[model samples]
Target chain A: MTNIKKLISKPLFLPIFCMILVMAVNIIFDAINGNFALNFFTISVRNGILYGRLIDVLNRGSEIAILAIGMTLVVSCSAGTDISVGSVMSLAASFCCMLLAGFGVSSTSSYNVPLFVGVIAGILLAGVCGAFNGALVAFLNVQPMVATLILFSAARAIGLLLCNNLIVYVRVDSFGVFGGHLGILPTPIIIAAVCILVATVLLKKTALGLYVQSVGINRKASRIAGVRSERIIFICYIICGLCAGIAGIIASSRITSADSNNIGLNFELDAILAVALGGNSLGGGKFRLAGSIIGAYTIQAITTTLYALGVSTEQAPVYKAIIVIIIVAIQAPPVKAFFARRQAKKAALKGGVA
Target chain B: MKSLKKINGNTLLLLITIALFVVMYIAGCVVYSTKGFTHLQTFLNILINNAGLLCVTCGMTCVMLTGGIDISVGSLIAMDCMFIAVGIEKWNMNPILLMVLVLVIGAVFGMVQGFCVGYLKIQPFIVTMAGMFFGRGMTAVICTEQVSVSSSELFVKIAQTKIELPFGAYTNNKGVLQVPYVRIPVVIALVVLIIVFLMLKYTKFGRSLYAVGGSEQSAVMMGLDVAKTKLKAYVLSSVLCSIGGICFCLNTMSGSVQQATGLEMDAISSAVIGGTLLTGGVGNVIGSFFGVLINGTISTLVKTNGKLLSSWSNIAVAALLCFFIILQSVFAKIKEKSK
Candidate 1:
């Protein structure tokens, strides 16, 4: 009972709660509108609205979820946030498109040798961009915001320049299959799950993860304890870059075209929002992969619910912004402390009665 | 001499930026002369046209110095443009009244952000980010589409009137000239710079901004009203942003929500290129002016080339932003080593 209570009070619990709450509210709304039915221990809903949309949520959630996992590591290293992940993703996508196109494969090729090659090349390019960002923040001692902001603008421009500001389409069956699903499980969702699993194990079972948490808690103390803070930051960025590259592939594959300008636009914002909403402190310490996954799903579910309720696409950002504000407000220390104190008083009264 | 030495590093950075500007301009001149499309009048016009960005960048530098940022400035400019268009075109208000309205609106927007950030202890980035969304959304809500001002006699006169000065002439058609009235905003920006420079150097509040930015805990311990100081800084930045916005609207005689979409980035890049540290506590308004000039010159150079995409401006600005940030990092390291 104590272990269960402790688990419920954990920071990771909030994102899951948020997701479940949103899902419940959505189902209640659906039921009122006669879209859901419950018949003797069985439940049914409109297939398009619930199950089909869940697939969409999973597909879209994958990129941000993966990026947030890597971002968790970067933030845990006390290197601050990277706002250039979106730009890096775009650069990778553009590079892949350019490579595939250079190989003379039309937009409708069934088998293309260059497709896998392009993915590898794109990942490498993204890694290099990440290294550049990490170098500035770790070695040059520039603020993470400014260093990444430079790369954010420059990388996107470089991508657009490389692609001549054109959207390039590539048709590769293997690439499409990577983004497609098997038995109602989207490939991106599977990829995200695998990435989360890896992150969870690495963070929970590895010395490097502990070192990163120490650095985040107190850089001076961590350094005194012989942790290589700079190297940790560098490695974290490399991982972030790799995740961003994978996200680019999924995003581009979904559209069947790589748009230099629009591909991965505002992705960094989404990833950061996911990380923040997942109860990962912007001030950084312990990492939370499950929380981030739940957070991403929550965001997607909210949008899906709003859209189903006939909300305009333009209005979605406004609602999402409000939700973000509320989540952050609740997560604020003062608010949490108020609730904690209330719970403590209630527990004391119950003990006295007993 | 001690102050000079302290200011010397920033000055050297400014000089290097100016040198780069000159080199780029010379290269543009060569390209234009070779293409037989160089025009002295056109070059002067470009400088005058870019004065509004110069004003906006000036405000950005001040805000950045205080360890804060305002991405909402671009959207504020959009709002200003809408209001100005509505005031002049719809209500037929006096042009000066429009300007005053813009300033007041900008100040209010800034104050709200300042209150959230300074008093509520909210993060500057999150507050400003919220402000950006709200301001842009408000602009769109106010004006469904572009609003063009047609019959503002005062604004049109200000924009159309040109005071030509004799200079270098490549041809009779391109007689050497300068437009004084068109560059009025630049002059206004210069006056603001002078006043701000004095305040930064002499006033307690100005000193407190540096202290707070350098170390908020230390500033609080030193009995400085860090909250008030920060609030005042942000409010001041917003007012300057408003002025720049109005000037921009006045220059174009039109207002659109999409106008100044990336203007915040332009202002930030200019501030960074001018030697403002991203971590705050150190910057110069004058250097920021040259930073804007460099950006302006790049666009002009691209325009002169005729073959290159105008987006080369963004590329050039990005390059400069990266270069100067690297430079700032090196300087910071030197300072740290000295300490």
Candidate 2:
């Protein structure tokens, strides 16, 4: 009983609860609306893969979910947020499009560019941009948000400059693999799973996670303990960049075009919110990858639910914000303290009765 | 040597910012001279055009001085503008009362965020980001379409009332003579900057802001009201943001949900470029004032160049921001080395 209670008390429990709560609400809403033709709760097999909103939540949530994984590390290490991930995604998107289309935005000419070239260049260019951010944050000691702000405004310009501000359509049929299926599931779902798997292995199977958490908790103390704090921070940013690069590829591929101005817009905020929802402290320290991954899907599910409920696109954000604020407030330290005190009082009363 | 120690590191950064502005302005002038942009009015126009930004930057500087940030200020500007527009257009409300109402709303918005940040110990970024979403979402909820204040006599008068200098007029290529004057909004922005400067330099609250930013625990040890100081800083930021919204509305004579998209970035970049350290404890409003001017100069230069991509301004501003951040980093390094 104590073990079960302790497990429920973990930070991961809240996000899991939220995920279930949203899913349950969607199910109830669907049942009431008599939308039996399209099942909202159960995943259906479509061809050789899965279909329905359950799969849609994970599939659509993949991009920001990948971003949340990278963000989890950066946030845990530096106790700060990166507002440039969206721009970096755009940068990567533009580069990938440019590589494939040979700087020609219109697909009037066949893209002779190889698929591998676009993917590698997209990932690398974003990594380099991330390096610039990391250099400022890790080496120069600038605040993460301020350092990232440099890229946030300019990354679009750089993206536009690369593609000459033209919207590029991906003409190659082969490029569809990124957005299409791979065996029994959507490719993005597989990519996101691989990303989580790799991150889990890297953090759990090695000492990197410990070092990062220590650095995040207290840099001076970590430094005294012989942790290479700067390198961990720099690598985390690079990882974030790589995640964005992958997200950019998926985003562009999903649309079959690259619009630097609009691609991955506002994704950084979503990722930050996801990490927060996962019960990870923005002040940095320990984290739960599984919880954050669930948080990402929960956010996506909320957006889906709002759209399904007939909320206009503009009005949807308001509902999402309201829900997010409530969740965040509940997670706030003061609220947590209140609950803890209340529980202790109940325990004392029970002890007196006994 | 003793006097040099008194000048502080931020002063060095301020000097560099001033020097960069001078160089950029001279370069702009050289380009302007050839492009028929040499009028004295062009110089004043920069100040006038960026009146809203100037006010926003002043508030941002104060907030940064307290080692906190308010990303929602941009959304607050949008909300304030929308509220005023709705009041003027739909309700037949008094414009003065509308202004007061928006300011109060802005203050309450800041107070809520401050309460979360300062007392509840929530992260400022998260709270403000939530606030940003709420403000922007609320703007759309009130009215998704643009609300034009151009029809309002007061709005038009405020927007169009320009304080003409005693300077001469310039004849355009069409041979039409044009008399140039700074708008009333510009005058208000400059006045606000001066007032903010005085408030920061002379007031007890101002000193308390610096003390708290310098070291929150130490400030508490010194018997300072740390939470209240942080809270007031946010309130001040929000109030100034409302004032900025008024200036912005005066410039546009309209309001839309997207009126000030990413304006928060502009304000923060301005504060940073102006020599205000993000870490807080050391900065001046005068520097933030100049940073606004620099942004205007870049935009004007882009406009005058005619063929340059609009993205160039963002690129240039980002580059300058990068350079200034490097300078700040070097200053930090020097400070650490000396210690």
Candidate 3:
């Protein structure tokens, strides 16, 4: 009983509960339609690959899951959200496609540059963009939103200029591998898993996570304790940029083209929402990777559920807003405090009666 | 000398913005001397083009002054436009009545968001983001197809009505007179700007907004109602944004889900460039007006060049935003050192 109590009291408990709660809605939805209650949980093999609603959620959620790892760190270190990740994703995808299909050439069946070279260049450019934002925020002390606002508007435009105001399509089969399948498993799922694993290991194996939390909690105190707080913040943003680049590649590779205008539109919002849904405070400090990953998948689950229920794409945001409000209100401090106070009152009354 | 010493950080940033606008305008005139950039009509055209942006930026300035943000403004504008367009076209409602309904909706929307942020202590970004989603989704629900207000007699008349300037009249190559003029929206926007300027300068509620933004704890200690102030600020912002939406609808004469998309960023950037701090507490409506003008002029310059792509204007605005932010930071550092 004590062990169960401790598990229930864990910091990660709320996010896991929320995730399960969201997925449970699908179960209810299925049962109401006279389908099996476990319909949402069923997984089957098709064409030597796993396929199911659950699998779809995992597969579709790869980009946000990958972006969440970096977002968690950035929020922890800087106590501010990066609003440029969506634009950076679009920019990186544009650069990769532009290189693959040479400048002034909108469509190509052959590569102008090696696939790996283009991918690396895209990620590196994203890193450079990150560095610029970091310099402004970490050294020059500009607000994170204000500093990143520069890229949020400019990156997509630069992407447009690079693509010569056209969507660059690389119809090459090899370019599709990242967004396609490898040995019956979607490559995007594998990529997201690897990124999450690497981030988890890096955070667990080093003192970097501690330093980031310390800086987030109290920058002056951390600096006094010999931590390079500014450097830590800069590194976080660079990692975030790199993550966006990888996600961008996967995104573009799925379509086998870079549509700069629409790719990753409003994705930064999703990434931030993932972090919030993970039960991490937006004000910064301690965090958990598992929770954020779950949050990302939960978001995808919500979308998949809505689609299965026949909601049109245009109307999905309204339902999404309603769900988000309910969830956020539940986690609100006042609501929590109210519940806690009620519980205390109940306990006191029971003791008096006994 | 005594008055010079009183030039604090807020006033200093405002002065810097004014000077930058002046320099950029002069440079534009010199570079495009043959293109009539120096003509008074060109300046009026900037104001005419960005009237909706001007009103929206004023609302953004108010929210920023209270240390909050409203990204839903863009989405709300879309909703307002769709409501007006559909109400008049499909529902066959009165234009003036439809506008009043939009303002009421804006108030209720703002009230809900303000209650969440102020009373529940939720993050403004998250609340407003949800609001953004809700507004946009509702717009799509209202009408998935674009509805142009072509058949509405009153709307068309209001849109076509132009107030011509007495000066800046010139003769064209065809021996016809070309008199510079602005539409009714420009007049409305300017009136709003003046009203906001005065309110921010003299009203008690406005002073409380600055106090709460400067520091919440201090504001509470000063016996000011921080939550109420925040709530009122949001209400003011949304009301202004709805008014701006009317202006935007007048300009476009159509309603679509994509209408005024990404406009929130424009308003926020304008407020920031106009010397409003994101951290809150220092801003001027007059400065924000010039910020809108600066953005307008950049696009105008790109248009007049005729050779450059329109995307260049976006890049130019981003660069200008970067410059102004850096300048503000340096000025802040200097002030800290002096203190």
Model 3: residue B240 alpha-carbon error in angstroms: 0.3
lDDT of 2 by residue, A225-290 (tens): 898899999999999889989999998888877889898876887898899889887779988888
Q: Second chain TM-score per prediction?
A: 0.89, 0.95, 0.95
Give candidate 2 misplaced runs (Cα > 4 Å): A1-7, A45-49, A344-354, B1-6, B168-177
Off by over 4 Å in 3: A1-8, A34-37, B1-6
State which candidate has the highest lDDT: 3
DockQ of every candidate structure: 0.38, 0.63, 0.66
Model 1 over residues B249-278: C-alpha lDDT tens digits?
867788886788778888899888777777
- What lDDT tens digits, residue by residue, belong to model 2 across residues B1-339? 998887777887888788888999988888679776577788888987889999999988999998988898888899889988988998888788898898899899889888888888787777888888888888988899999985568767777887887768777779998787899888889899999999999999989999988989999999999889899989999998999999998888778988887788888888998999888898889999889888889989999988888888898899988988888889889989999
* lDDT at position B291, candidate 3: 88
Error of 3 at A300 (Å): 0.5
lDDT of 3: 0.89
User: C-alpha displacement of B208 in model 1, angstroms?
Assistant: 2.5
Candidate 3 docks with a DockQ of 0.66
Error of 1 at B287 (Å): 0.4
RMSD of each: 4.4, 2.2, 2.0
TM-score of 2: 0.95
